[model samples]
Target: MSVYVGNLSYQATQDGLTQAFSEYGTVKRVQLPTDRETGRMRGFAFVEMGTDAEEDAAIEALDGAEWMGRDLKVNKAKPREDRGSSQGGWDNRGGSRRY
Candidate 1:
């Protein structure tokens, strides 16, 4: 299962996540997304665990937990389209200008 972790440190690395989650179980993969332009961590990442139980353990232990002084928000990751931006809105008029 894949879990999403948020409110992460900008300096966090894939290995850092892997090691942290390894306490629960084997980590399939730990991927930290980075901005293409600045090459900086996006403050979130996806971790793939070996099994559902492991995923559950990670979520239970990591959710709302503090790491490097940041409160880690852990949960199953929603797809890109499923996650609306912080602004939270939809354009009923579509992409075109009404003018």
Candidate 2:
């Protein structure tokens, strides 16, 4: 399980997140996604801790806590939903069909 941390400053870094979360327990990983076009931090991150207990502790402690000039939105991360394919619009391919 992992924790979702939101409302982060654009300047926040993985090391900073690791350091902040490490106080609760061992931090396994920190993922900070970025904008594909601009290549900028997305103002959120996912932190994987050693155990659920540690994650809970960190969540309880950090949620709504002000950090980096923003209130943290910490909680368990929801499983990623499969987005299927990117070509989900009207089928314009050349195919003959009676209307």
Candidate 3:
């Protein structure tokens, strides 16, 4: 399982996250998502550790811990919700078209 790290600095880097989490245990992977259009960091990331224990330790140690001038929100990553449709818009308009 991976840990969800939020409220991160936009300048935060994958290597930086790995290094920070490594203090508790081995960091397996770090995913820092970016805005597609802006091509900028989304101020959050997902971190996968070598073991559940390591994840827990990192979460416990890092949650609300200030890093990079921002308080981090760290916890067990929740499964991504399925939005069903990739195309997003006003899908429910009762068949009415408005300008």
All models: lDDT? 0.89, 0.94, 0.93
Models ranked on TM-score: 3, 2, 1
Instruction: Give the lDDT of residue 53 in candidate 3.
Output: 95
Which residue segments of model 3 deviate by more than 4 Å?
85-99
Clashing pairs in 3: none
Write the residue-wise lDDT of candidate 2 on 41-83 in tens digits. 9999999999999999999999999999999999999999986
Q: Name the TM-score of candidate 3.
A: 0.86
Candidate 1 lowest-lDDT run of ten: 90-99
Cα deviation at 86, candidate 1, in Å, is 23
Clashes of each: 0, 0, 0
Q: List candidate 1 stretches off by more than 4 Å.
A: 82-99
Local accuracy of candidate 3 as per-residue lDDT tens digits, 9-72: 9989999999999998999899999999999999999999999999999999999999999999
In candidate 2, which residue ranges exceed 4 Å CA deviation?
Answer: 85-99
Q: Each prediction's TM-score against the native?
A: 0.79, 0.85, 0.86
Models, CA RMSD each: 4.9, 4.1, 4.4
Candidate 2 lDDT trough over 10 residues, lowest sum: 90-99
